[model samples]
Target chain A: MKNNEITDITPKRRLFELNLGDVWKYRDLVMLFVKRDFKNSYKQTVLGPLWIIIKPFLSTFVFTVIFGMIANISTDGMPQFLFFMAGNILWSFFSSCLNGSSSTFIGNARLFGKVYFPRLVMPCANIIYNTIGFLINFVMFFILVLIYMFTGSNVHPNLCALLMPFILLSSALLGTGCGLIVSSVTTKYRDLGVLVSFGVTLWMYITPVVYPVSQVAEPFRPLALLNPVAPLIETFRYGFLGSGTFPWQYLILSFVVTAVVLVFGIIVFNKVEKNFIDTV
Target chain B: MREMNENCVIKIENLSKEYRLGAIGSGTLRHDLQSWYAKKRGKEDPNQRIGAKQYTKGDTFLALDGVNLEVNRGERIGIIGTNGAGKSTLLKVLCRITAPTDGRVRFRGRIASMLEVGTGFHAELTGRENIYLNGAILGMTKEEVTSKIDSIIEFSECEKFIDTPVKRYSSGMFVKLAFAVAAHLDAEIMIMDEVLAVGDMRFQKKCIKKMRDLATEEDRTILYVSHNMNTIRDLCDRCIVLDHGKIVFDGDVEDAIKIYLGSANENFRALEYVGNEHKHHADRNDLCLQFVRYNGKEDSNLSKKSYHCG
Candidate 1:
């Protein structure tokens, strides 16, 4: 019963008070949420977690046939199969992170309404869970690249390949940021929730996931790179397949945009979380 | 700012909450656009319900208005109120589930709330796993829950189904397990919202006994909200009655219940009594006397007889 343990409940805190220490105190809860996500997503399924790899495998096959074979899109002279696989793995991670985190307020409205916890735990769990899936896909992609290399294919991973973790994290941060922003808005207006999945689909096409960024018209290349995800995907392909462009300046620009979005998203999320239950 | 007393465990000043009327987003883009257009013309919000009384601010009304109170340590308080009495809203604000529109509450020590039992239970998770999950959600560390895990399971009386998914458990069993977890929470202040409305009679009695022990033995402060005045009288030494976001009575338990039942008001009349006529209802379980009306006549069994009126 120490008097110094007093906690004040007020209507407004500072706008940028992200309450990171509160989140840190609840780290165990975050891990539990991640564990729950992992368990629930695969439970009772025939393939269980194998679906994570199977998903990318099927999507890569479709993109190779549709974009590489039929549309005859160039892969910057890299093998079309591996090229598509690289983009698919990275893009799926980013998109899933975005879509999953975007529904934080809406999906857990019942849970959020009943109890009090740092609201960021939901999206943090989502990103970590999605990151686990991305790691599995990355392993599968790496094995494929190794097999292709032994067979004397020109595709070889370079020193740039070591930047994969950074690329993955940036994509995760960007997606979670955008998702938090959308979730905050969707608490008041559910139309945004309905629009998120479709919007992510459209976002992928512009992100050079199926085609090389080089194929975009020269004048529009800079515009496409401004997408933040565009350069990250290019860097991923550059690292793994060793054929895509790696514009250092654009990469820096992508990181800057990600930082801005993540910071802004957190601020908006903090503001809404105080009383989002009333509206949500 | 007011000076806080050393013994005061909770202090509130001018607490108020305002909730928007009608729809938060009007449920559709067209309606939102219409509201926006109407606002631009300095007209009433198109989304506002027709003939709804507008408060001082448009389409918003206070749930808790200028409530101020302070509680000393180790006080077992019962909060009684009718529907829409802001009892739940005040608990929500204290638990930090939702922020107040204005004012603040300062409290010492951690607050564990049972606003609703099983707040984060997953259907796919086993009963044992959910105990851990729910414990964590209520701010208990893993080791803390681990140490109390055996007692929690034992208290729940669901030992056989501990490893089974909660979805497979009966509704009664679900509530039993949920209450067990909440009962084990080690916090200085416990805020509960009518959690005993479910479960069997034996279990309800067990819960009441356990809570009484916690308040007396552990010296923890307890604030219970309930419509069951019998339990209130049994557990709380002090009581507060709320109506329309204001405290109507705050004193002895018997007096508070009298005020809540309208027996203390001369103009109020009791239309119905809890006679054996309502005994045939299948849901009737606790038939203890709750309220009585004198009607200017002496009845020795009046306290024993319960009356019902609104």
Candidate 2:
């Protein structure tokens, strides 16, 4: 599809057209919502923005102690703390976007009912805020790596690290696509909310966050790779830790799935946004 | 009709919105299951069987029914009605926030509606951020909002708190900023619903002035819904009176107010007040109308008799 021709004309198309130009026109509103989410997420807290660092900091510490120390998990030549932190930060961003976008309609029903802005702006804002949080956490992870290097622990920094932002974007796009689909469905069927909360948690295990993809058994490895997030996370870890197996085929598959899901998400989101206030 | 078309920017015809208020739990599940079952059976809905009581009395209500009206460009129209008279619902339909169930509304230009102050505001956002946000939500482009940002903040009188999170703002300041963004929105048609009631009297005066200026100077169509009859009279060139989801009167401001006030007077008379029964009657007819009080000594004449109408 061309850039300008974003609309799909189906026979089942409802009353109104979904105008992407309107969404583009309302980009400032999207930014404001992003700012609101960023500030309100940590406002009134004693730690303030430090909570962004502290959350993944503590989670990485726990994972390093339990999975790296106690279970003696292999870090594939990279420092255990750095290895797990990278995975945690990446997964945290994706999960946060998913959880936030999934609740978009239900969370803002009052505002949605009173206003007529493109509802896509809410989820788009969520993706932007989560990306910022991920960037902050990523910076902290890098600082921790430098600390480990100063302490004489072996750490290899590779050129692939430059690809971190692209990986983050891919994950965000995937998360946003899935999140919008869930949010749109949840507006009509409230059960989708309950199901998604549990689904995301289970999905994290299937993605290779706790363990390296190399550890998965033979037959199940292909099935695990089939999980769209699995390849994205694997690629992110490979870019950072320089350890995980990066299959180009699975990467292509993940990109295809992300695009398809995103298109479906936008379609469903646009459809629901028009009249979801009534249904909600 | 041709002459009316020249001035009119909005024409709503046969507009009706229906809402189905299903019974509590079992009814929803029953309807869902029955619909699914009927779909599988490849037949018409069994629930639509003859005399099935498709809707119970308490379960259904029509918010609007066959409402038709025309609003002209550059005309300041005030929609006045009592609560639940579907004033807000009509605006919602026109704004396309909610679709009409059975009719169409044809609008000639972009519509910006302030159904309530701060409709999509996030308390955590700063006033400056929210100005752009609110403007964009009202359908302005970022560039348009950026150009109008200074004027919006100036008009709102919220310069000191421009960078502060709106959560810290007092309710009055929040409303002021919200209304400012709305007022500055560059839309052809502006629909305001009691938003001027939020701020202080001075701010209300400023808002009314701005709305008046928009209608006159900018030649924008304005549709205002407010309970403030005096403000309506002062600000609007034309007015519409709605009663029971229908337009009872639509014309020049004076005629509309007269119809509205006349009906209100009748309603007030029908409502019995102790020791004030004869207050509302016109003193024209002696036999048909009765007065219960007289300031002077009573005479034997029927015109001088102080009698209450029975």
Candidate 3:
């Protein structure tokens, strides 16, 4: 018998009580939530997962024509299609994760109100689900790269290509961290909910998703790297398409900033989870 | 550690939950900011009473007030109360679905709550998938649900449709499947809130029997909230009656029900006293509603306007 098991409920929980152990114990529930997301997201739809592929494909083509041709944005001397696809893959991954986690509380209020599992499970499940979506997008990008390579393109994926996993982890963390903070605040002041999607759209313009960081004026280049996601996308292009600079200091700063944002997000999220049922 | 009884499986002390009477945070950030600015300038909140402080009596609704309780192992406790009298709030706080505004609750073992059946079930998921999802939400691991899947399917008696989506199932079938999953929960403490209100009469009896066996054989502690006096009498060894966010009675089942109905009759009498001309009309209407709500079997007499029974 598990005599040592016990649980206490109180009006207030400590600020740092993240309950990571409970999240681990409820790992099955997290997986089930992820599976539910997968099943329900595409259910009864004819196109289904094809939408995942078509979305980025269409966006890539649009960016290639609009920015690459009309605006004459420098892709740092890379093919317009590949340049847009690489940036599209990383940006979409981070933004989707951010948008999804941003609505975690409001989206699952019914489930959270009736059950007692760790509240972190919802955000964690979303991060995993969005990661799966991100991976699919990445694979499509990779296949496009291979087709470009076979057709006599000058693209060369370097040793930096191995950093794909690390880049992905940091980006996911950053996105969910910011999303969690927004989710927590929206519990009380829902005005933020209306602004989240719009803010993410505006945020993309400043992060060099369509245009390379190299195109930024020299004076403002450093300022651009200060945005944590800037160096992530830059490094992603640097590795995969071999077109962008490898600023190691900016990448390190990006990771440190990601770690801090993620920690702060989780703390705020934990604080709100205790009583969010009232406000949400 | 606080002093706890060795046999007590659940303990709640000075528990209270207060909710703002109106929209949360005064409805908008603009109003919240206005209130904050007013407070900073040494003025009363513009959104609140002219001279009243925050959380004043009129500003908040006390859902549960200073409730203290303890339950030993293998006890089935029935909680009865009028709507908004805090029965559901008590179960919610105990389940940790919502935080209490004051005090604390401690439990000695694993607690599984069915605040509502099919709590996390997705409409698109099949009955089998929903069983797994619902079980996981109730704190069961994948292996635990896997082991009990067959028994759950058999208990629901919808084996043929187990693979079909729950959205396609009749409401009765859905409740049966959901209850079957909740019935198979492996926990030392179970908190249920009127989960058997749906489904056929035979199924409700079967569920009550299942809960009884769980309490007797497995020594699980159960805290059940229901308005049905018969079920309370049939299933509970102990009973609690709440009135206006306070525990008016807690004792043997028969005595608790007596106190509950006694007070209910008094409330009706008070209502009748407030209006003399419509006394007879109001009395019959209230009784008919109460009969239909609290006692389904007496619904046959709902048509009788002169029906008067205490």
Candidate 4:
């Protein structure tokens, strides 16, 4: 035992005493997990990471067929490919955050069961990995933006486009916050793990991924705005596609909700991780 | 200097861990709701069973019940016990991998543990990558692992295959690589559980020597758990025996081993008649019932017959 070192292993109960120091100390571990995610994700695939590029277009094809031509939903004035692809990219960023971070407890149970570090590192790593994915998807989305501009379509990007980084960060935060809570609760109720995947799909429909939030009729708009995810998607569409509304109140409200949920997620995650090995 | 109690660092106070008997959340929602209601009423947990003695099949099992121990710096304590004796559970609680259901532990140190072979190894990752990943998982910084990566690979004797994915490595090679990282992990308190079991004879001797050096030369406190009495005796100056989630003996190393070995046979005899607690070996019917005819002759009557081994 060292003279300066002191550790107390108690039944920890204090909420929101998030240990930032340990998380900062284990930044290398976060990076390792991020690296592992990239390696493991496309390990056996012939295309390796290039599959990520093919993925967006494939999903955009499905969305265009289902939501654009088949269902005849309006994309305001922008081209359908541009609109659907933009939504596809943002949705990918959003869902990846949820899918990656929320399963942190259950997915990494073996590793977590044997070692002790800040439990937050696992989810944080997933967010970082998802952020990298978002950036890649953004680059792909940027190419489509250029093609539309060269063809002389009115694909005007507003000043709000500069808020792309903040929008993506908030989206990642929201997904991670929600995922952490689900992952924490999953130790006790494994049904939540099943529900998370199904729920995120339903969550995407309400977030204006397939259609504009303005497409929803008058009485349901406030209900859709209450989702927090809707406002970010709307702001993102407004910034990039130049064809949607950016309600500042809803944006602040989403930020507040994300902050609160992230705090709660950290609290519950910290609580469950310490003894999850026994239950797990 | 260790004789004086002032160097004491780890002080455990009535540490306990309770495990639910069945299901992920302990059976149906009704049970969980009932537990919640009980806690809400400021009453004892409805499923809380006092388990200082032994565990019976129940709605909950007490894996550890009020364990208390103290150790000074640099003491290599051997934890020995039979299956379900809470040996691994005790180590898990100390490593903070699992929280105790009750009580607290106070220690001064950065604790590093290798509880199982290849604990955090990913099969798809190369040996070099796994080293950095596993070392980081064990709380070592990346630079620390980077600085020692060469030595770790050399120690594992897997130099030619360091860049190959761990899945291609044989089981023995995997364990060696895992153990190499664990051994090099820097910490004030080190824990190892049966790490020497999988190694070859010569490698086992080398690991033992390394463990001895970690304890004596580096002055790191170690808590080693193993069923092999010889290694325990060789490595530990003191030992603690746990039986049924409670420490039955804590004393001189040899005495603890003797008590542990003796009680195991004592328990075998005790289990001959589960319902009746006090049947003597001679009075017990199971002894002579071995060769008794199934023609309804009383086992007691068969006690007069002689039996010979095959």
On DockQ, the candidate that comes out on top is 3
Clashes of 2: 0
Which pairs clash (backbone N, Cα, C closer than 3 Å) in model 3?
A: none
Model 1 / residue B250 / CA error / Å: 1.2
In candidate 2, the residue pairs with backbone N, CA or C atoms under 3 Å apart (3 or more residues apart, or in different chains) clash, namely none
Per-prediction DockQ: 0.64, 0.24, 0.70, 0.53
Clashes per model (N, Cα, C within 3 A): 0, 0, 0, 0
Two-way lDDT contest, 3 vs 4, winner? 3
lDDT (tens digit, per residue) of candidate 4 on B10-124: 8888998888754454534456787779879988667655653323456677889889899888899999865667998888888888888899987776888888878889999
Name the best candidate (by lDDT).
3
| Candidate lDDT values, in order | 0.84, 0.75, 0.85, 0.79
Chain A alone, TM-score per model: 0.97, 0.89, 0.96, 0.95
lDDT for A45 (candidate 2): 88
* Stretches of candidate 2 exceeding 4 Å from the true structure: A1-16, A45-47, A139-166, B1-7, B23-60, B125-129, B141-154, B157-169, B261-269, B272-310
Q: How would the candidate models be sorted by lDDT, starting from the highest?
A: 3, 1, 4, 2
- Runs in model 1 deviating more than 4 A are A1-4, B29-34, B41-59, B263-310
Clashing pairs in 1: none
